[model samples]
Target chain A: MFGLEKKDARLLILVAVLVAFAPFILNPFPEGSGLAQFNAGYPDLMQRFVIFGIFAIGFNILFGLTGYLSFGHAAFLGVGSYAAMWMMKLLTMNVIPGIVVSVIVAGVFSLAVGWISLRRSGIYFSILTLAFAQMSYSLAYSVLTPLTGGETGLQPKITDPRILDAALAPGATPKANLFGLEMGSSVELGMGSWLFTFNAGYYVAAIVMLVAFYMSIRIFRSPFGMMLRAVKSNQQRLNYTGLNTKPYTLAAFVISGMYAGLAGGLMVAMDTQVGAERMFWTASGEVVLMTILGGVGTLIGPVLGAGAIKYMENILSKINSDILHTWFAFLPDGLEDFVVTLIYPFIGKGWHLTLGLIFMAVVIFLPGGLVEGGQKIAKLFKRKSPVDDSPDGKTTPAE
Target chain B: MGILEVKNVGKRFGGLQALGDVNLSIAENSVHAIIGPNGAGKSTLLNCLVGKLIPDTGSVMFDGQSVLGRKPYEINQMGISRVFQTPEIFGDLSVMENMMIPCFAKRDGSFKPNVFINMLKDREIVERAEHMLEEMNMSDKRHMHAASMSRGDKRRLEIGMCLSQEPRLLLLDEPTAGMARADTNNTIDLLKQIKEERNITIAIIEHDMHVVFSLAERITVLAQGTPLVEDTPDNIKGHPKVREAYLGETQEAA
Candidate 1:
């Protein structure tokens, strides 16, 4: 339909359906229900799901295709956020300019970083990127204090002159918007005990995520993408075949960096703030984890991984000891206490322990990641369905 | 005047003079072979021709253009393609993809960021790749992974990839190294066919006398970083100096 192969087009439609109906899909539990704490339908968390999905999808283009792992990807995201913040603070509250400028600024920054770092490959390249990200993080935290707002971070303020925007009312606060539609504004739909909240910002981010995903699909099928894969397969052979590997790798790095920047811009548009912590090495590592966990080379794997990680970060971390105790209150007091204590560490702030275990399990049993797991399950079901036909076909074939 | 001219090319590796005062010319549309023992500098000279090594004392020219300072891909774009000792195909890619990459490289030059053009939809590239795969007799294995293919198949694919580019000069470094007898014979036949079918210059560095005698029109015998003799394969075979320096050693080794 969109100049895509049949299978890819179907996958895109399926994802579009999933994203468009995410509020309902993610909020399966009704309000005040015991499982309501696990619901991820709220505007803030929903925005993050799509935003990081964009980030991981971009990361996949580099790490998946070219096998160039940039541990400094989040630096581009941070740069984008800062750029978007400045755009909102000075130019306008509308997000179009902020997002556009963020992508361009991040592309330029990544070009410089990629040019130098791509000279090395394998582990050295990874470490070089890590060093660049750390440097950017440290600089933004300290030396670039005036520009980055240092430890305080940056926020749109009333005192700042917004040249492209109308003057704020006497005491009104600046809110990020899309042509006057406030990002945070949401419409609530209540049906009996279930309440679904659809936020303007979440929809905006989701649409952007869809576009990014489509573009990634296009790239995956492109001649350029084939060359990138060739780079990963055998760079020496590629060079000998009259195709330069340097420019291809550099282009992938910059394109992925721009994707990260788009994600960072979306984050600011949703929340209206920028922080240096976003550029931390851990944030960069998170995107890598997401890409590997979902599926390294598969097109939709990164998005699934991003959604899984972000969903866990929000829902699992929100499960405090109090909630655990309440859920187990039906058991005898001592038994309930024992159960809660045993399960407590894996939930709430200790969610990382659970995530770590899941990551290990995925890597060990499903090296192809969650996508492989899904495919295996699908195969199992298909095999079961053909059981009746298989016996008859076997006997008839023998005859 | 030959397609490739190597004159007084010397490469030193610190205290070791790998290639010293070598002069050779490979004529257009001819198969030339370089035969040497373990450290006879055959590979070094091949490397110098393909831009992998810079000669300290000579000019390596291709079609009147200096190929000394250019990068490997640049040299390749200038109508020269190299096949490695080990069949250097993209193992992870499918056979058809391996064939298509060279076609893309041939069409796009060193680098072209045409990121939006669908590879499968690019009829020109697909047709050319299909044609090459057919020519290589690997049409059925197009969907199979390149790594999973047998060694002979990989070598065939690599040679096919080089040929798809229609390179004016094709350089092979031990093209049939580490192959079974049957596979070695198959490769020889393929090379013979390629020679008869294409107007391409082939420069081969081989350790096997059988392959050289069957394929090379002219032979250059090198002994310790210098060519001892260069002549028609039949003449070179009968030369006393060639027999003592190269053929006699192989005869004894046998």
Candidate 2:
């Protein structure tokens, strides 16, 4: 319902096409590709892109649409993951049960958190949500260890049940199935030089992600989304106009929580693991970063952001001093060592520094993020020839 | 009997008495104007009527039903809509989308979960909003963002949004609060047009004497949280009590 702009609908279709064949487009330089580690084509990483995309999309419903900054939404994601893991452990080894459980748990959790936190507005509301998330995190780590599995996390063990699938034993060790379909199944294509492996779990995650993305589009175009925006722009006016914005805000919050839950469920389905770390405040902060980095209100922006951040996390961490030395082996011995040493800090743990700088630059220069930047750059080239002769034309603003 | 009635409405915010013994009645399809100085409890009285504040000791009846503790949306559903002092159009939404909201509310009287369906397919709503915008002479700017419009145009859009709901009573809190002379006159003309075209009762709180004198049939003067005088617009301009309470020395010499 997100009043889909004509441009946005076309963008969505383009994104869908890109995601459909990412494996080949992303891995063009297959032989000794330096970007292979950063490739979003791998099933594990692809699952992550979709899952976090769902997470950021949900976060946008509240923070983007309603202008309510929630610092505690990660708790819902973490809770969803834990709930999914529990479903895998106690109910069935199928991802369906995990997904259902995750959604319900997240919905209930958001209802409680939103009810209390929404009582306050602005920073106070943010702080309240933060406090609730921290409480959930603490409880998951220690107080609720029996149910949450504590610091060790709720990993799938040999004793887990698999009710639906007759082939998977009652004591199977972490088997993740979708319905009755095995997630481990994969198809290998092409000769030895060009191998493409298609994993079932990755496709499952992709399908779910697409559904969630479509749902968000609907919400944005709905009358409800309009009301939420009105609440954000002028809450007092809505109150006077005879509309109680509380229920609307709460609905947005709940919808966002469910999205986080779906992401959490898919995460466990891909890896069959859920940890207390998922609910950490930094994880919540990361989703906010994804939405902001991509373009908070833009539907596809968050998905692009999630992929970028995750790629950095995975690939950037692998570029150590040894890898650098391997790349610059032909250089002089001293020069190679110097170059490797210089690049060492920024490659691994220091990658976060680069990300932080990028975030800062975006917030300062491109407050509307990538969307505004792209529009400006497009306008710059589009009008350069005609506007070069006119002073007034150059002064004209895009906004 | 009055279509809407307020009896002995009183409210105190800690040390300040915002309203004290405020009483009024509104007949169906009549324009009622509430005028006062800055701290005259005019807005506080409106807040009480719309259920924004619970009056300490009084009751507000809308269409013969008590609206004292009802929620704002409930009040709206029961046929009352309000326009704020500063225009409160949905800043990001286009002009037409803003108008469609109240129309949806009026048609459904309940929220429908039709996120994917093309909302513009509702011909009735589209026609009604188009006609209302045409009346305001804002039909050309239908697709423009509400935030991009001028201050006067934004007010017109806000009034149109409220009117689209087809409320039985429209409460306006200083609809011409911050407009230039020409813009204020334009707003006055727009309001006069709406009154003539729609069968809706209107209660406006105004600081502008020009706006009040142009449209108000009856005027109630509020001073220090109490009604100084309630009379016809002609009588209100000449009332000695009103001049001392509000117009002060400037109008007295006239």
Candidate 3:
């Protein structure tokens, strides 16, 4: 409906349905059950999924369409976080103002970075972005310590002036909210053995993510999106075709940066803190990993990739050797130890190693990421039919 | 005054003089061909005109405006469009999408706030692109990936794309350089049709004598980075200096 093709509209509706039902679906196991650990319906984790989804969606606009692999988007995210934290410190605890400030701040910051980095293409452009991001991170760590809160990080304190809202009841701590709706508040509904907990913050974040996704869909189907794809397809031809590609690219970069900022603002709204570590180059690398792992250019690929990585990072990392032992207890003593040892490097603190292996597998086999894998499955089903099914109506479905 | 004026334009790269004190005045609505051997600065001079390579000395003026330091896209916006030797269409896009880019550029100038408008819903752009493709006889291949097309089709699509921009000046760098005879003749006919219908200026850099002589009303022969002769096709074919520069290459070529 929002400038989307029929297929694109269908995709948007599918995503909306999925996001709406996530809390119920993810929290299928009842509370206090052994499988509850896998329940991703928790407000904190659920919030991360949508926030990072926003980040990845924005990144796809730049990298997927324009083919500009920025290595410094985390800097924008960090800038957004810092802006949100300051907004909370200076203004009211209304998450709305904080979110707005973060997007604007990140947009401006990315504009300066993109203006300089877009001067070069290929790896040189990536390195230029990396240099700018690292500079921001280092500056936040030391030189800009007073503003950034240095080694500690920025946090809203009760003593600091909050001019917008009524003076807080003297000794109360500041809490991020939408008007007066507490972000941390949740409603838990239990039916028989299954318990579903939906947090206000996660729903808010999910709604924002839906809007971000809808906007991306509009962009992907727009003439502007065609220009961006054109930029990636043949920039030389585009220049000859009389398009100044710099503006198109710069606009993409800033838009992606604003998305990063939105993600950052959401993170602080949920957690109420800003850290210099968020600006680290490794953080930028994480987004790249998510995009590539899920399918670099596809609509739902980044979100799926982000969910997979975040799930592994938060859930699998929590599984210690003791849990492995409990699961393998039925085996003989020697076999149990052997099995635990074998699976040890793929979970718990070694979760990153598992992530790396999975990433490598995705890159080597399904270079289009998990979206390609899904397409392959769809193709197999179509092949079983009598009609020669053009899966997704293209030779390559995911790209 | 001609529509395009090159006055003492020279470009030196290290010790090599790519172009030296080159002077030419191309009239409006004329077909001008620049022919030279390899490394004779034919490409260098063309690059200078399109602002791809800034000449080390002298000036190039198109439509009475200096084009010395303008960017390639900026030069294009000044109503000059170039078709590359290797057919530079967007391989990742469909043929229709490839044609629409130039149409969009022409209608919206160099840049537009076209982000929010649905491409499929842009009836004007879609019709314009479809009409251009129909004229190129590529209407059926409109939805095919541009990169998958035959070389002849690719060249045709590129020319169609350039023409869709409705440029005042069309620069063709060996439009039929690597084509079979059939495809070459097709390209020639296409150019003829375009010429009759558009009333636009064409400056082509070509190596084929037959193709050059058949199409060019006036020819500029370049040798060692300088214009050797500028004359009518009949005179160029018979002139001793032109033959001397050609070194009997045309006879053997024929």
Every model's TM-score on chain B: 0.98, 0.95, 0.98
| Candidate no. 3 TM-score | 0.96
How well does candidate 1 reproduce the true complex, by DockQ? 0.49
Docking quality (DockQ) for each candidate? 0.49, 0.31, 0.60
Q: Please list the residue runs of candidate 3 whose C-alpha ends up more than 4 Å from where it truly belongs after superposition.
A: A31-34, A383-399
Candidate with more favorable, higher lDDT: 1 or 3: 1
TM-score of each model, paired residue for residue: 0.96, 0.91, 0.96
Tens digits of lDDT, candidate 2, A160-236: 55454454555555678877677877776654555566778878887887778877777776667767666776776
The pairs that clash in candidate 1 are none
- Collision count for each candidate, in order: 0, 12, 0
> Which number leads on lDDT?
1
What's the best-to-worst order under lDDT?
1, 3, 2
Q: Give the lowest summed-lDDT range of ten residues in model 1 chain A.
A: A390-399
Q: Kindly report the docking quality category of candidate 3.
A: medium
- Per-residue lDDT tens digits for candidate 2, residues B116-218, read 6555666887888898788778988887777889999999999888888878999999999888878999999989988998898999999888788899988
Ranking by DockQ: 3, 1, 2
Q: Which of the numbered candidates is closest to the native, going by highest DockQ?
A: 3
